[model samples]
Target: MGRHKALPYVHRTFRGWHVRRTWVNTGEVSQLNRARIVSAAIDLIEREGADAVSMRRIAADLGVGVMSLYNHVPNKAALLDGVAEAVLSEIEFTDDPSAHWTDRVRAQARSFRQIAHHYPRSTMVVVSRQLQSSSGVIPVEYALSTMLSAGFDGREAVQLLRVFIAYIVGSLLREVGVTPTFAPVRPDVDVAAIDGGLFPVVASLAGELVKCDHDEEFEFGLEMLVQAMIVRRGARASTSEPPESGVIPSPGLS
Candidate 1:
């Protein structure tokens, strides 16, 4: 009987053959998949703004061909969806059934805030797009279910969810200094240039107004909204019972 000989692995590129090594791990090769691609894209977005993210850049970062990325993500739009999902997955929903709905809402809000702050550069990318990924849907579904189980009607639940989303996105934008229509102006702009007599109050508080503690501001606003919603929930519950004719009269009318 003849002894069998071991085969060597060859590494090739478009230019030429690269270094050949034995004992290649197939498992390591399989690790480069969709999740890895999405993670690389997210890292690119985090290091540089979304504008800096591209298939070519990501491929270079991963030491793969740009065309190879398409096998995982169809296009930039799909890649962005993945990135959004990746960001959304950072929010963990609590499984505690005994937690109050308001507490759940607060937890979600805080989670969103922390994630947004963690990736300040990528916040715009995360918040600007409408998320359709499962990871994105999980937190939303959790919040909606909590609200519905807590006695909020479909319309009220949806509207309240929108209010929370809008508040958080707006707060994130302000915190990240990304204004809607223009670059952020320096806070150190001279306040004395403005006529003090014409805008006395504005001039007086300019210093305080310019300096913001995003965490404190977010918490204050969130607490106020939560308290207001709590009052609204109580009021809604009180008026939930229908009249004698099964037709409840609208308030503030005859």
Candidate 2:
């Protein structure tokens, strides 16, 4: 009988799975699965920004054929969604029922900042996508629940949650040098070269403007938001009395 040759990669026909093996120092092999694929996508995003994330690029990073990634990711949009979920899963949520609502909110926000700092370039994937997966929705559910427990009605809680996410996203975008148009910030301009006559204040604070302490500024904004929430809850409590008419004024102008 002739000897059979072992293939470098394998595809199981029964389950329609594609698997790749890589040699390790311990002589064991690691299988490339959806998790590994998503991780490679995140690595690409971190190194080359979100635009670099593609099935072919991730497959190259993982040392596999481009078609191999399709078995797991299916398409580019699914791949990006996976990246967002993976990054969000890194957040260590503190949902201690005994903790004060404000403390819980602060803990979640701080944890979010840590993840943002860890993946400055890839974090935007999370911000731009609506996280429908469990991993991404858990943090949001925690935030909404905290707001509700702190005495916010359903609409109020949703609106407050949107503002909270906006603050974090805006801060991280600035830290990562991404502008409103999603382009990288222009290289530092020479403030001294600017026309002092036209913009006196910008010239005067050039020293301070150039040396920003992002951490300190982030904390300042976070505390201000928290305090404002506290004040709002107190005011809502005091105004619990019903209006003469059942009509509740809309939250904003049409």
RMSD of each: 12.7, 10.5
Cα lDDT tens digits for candidate 2, 1-254: 33222222323222122234433332122556786787678778888889987788888887789997888778999998988877777675547767777788888799889888988877889888887877777777888888988778999999988888899888988876665321224355566666788999887876666666778988999978887776677666644433213233333211
Clashing pairs in 1: none
- Error of model 1, residue 164, in angstroms: 1.0
Off by over 4 Å in 1: 1-31, 180-187, 239-254
* lDDT of all predictions: 0.69, 0.72
Cα error, residue 18 of model 2, in Å, equals 29
Give the number of the best model, judged by lDDT: 2
TM-score to true structure, per model: 0.74, 0.76
Local lDDT at 22 for model 1: 43
Q: Supply the TM-score for candidate 2.
A: 0.76
What's the lDDT for residue 169 in model 2? 83
| Model 1 agreement with the true structure over 1-254: per-residue lDDT tens digits | 33222223323332222222244443455445776677677778878779988889999987888899988889998888877766666553454447767677888788777777766666667767788766666667777887886678999999988898889988887766666322225544566566789989977876675565678888999988876676566667734433223223445211
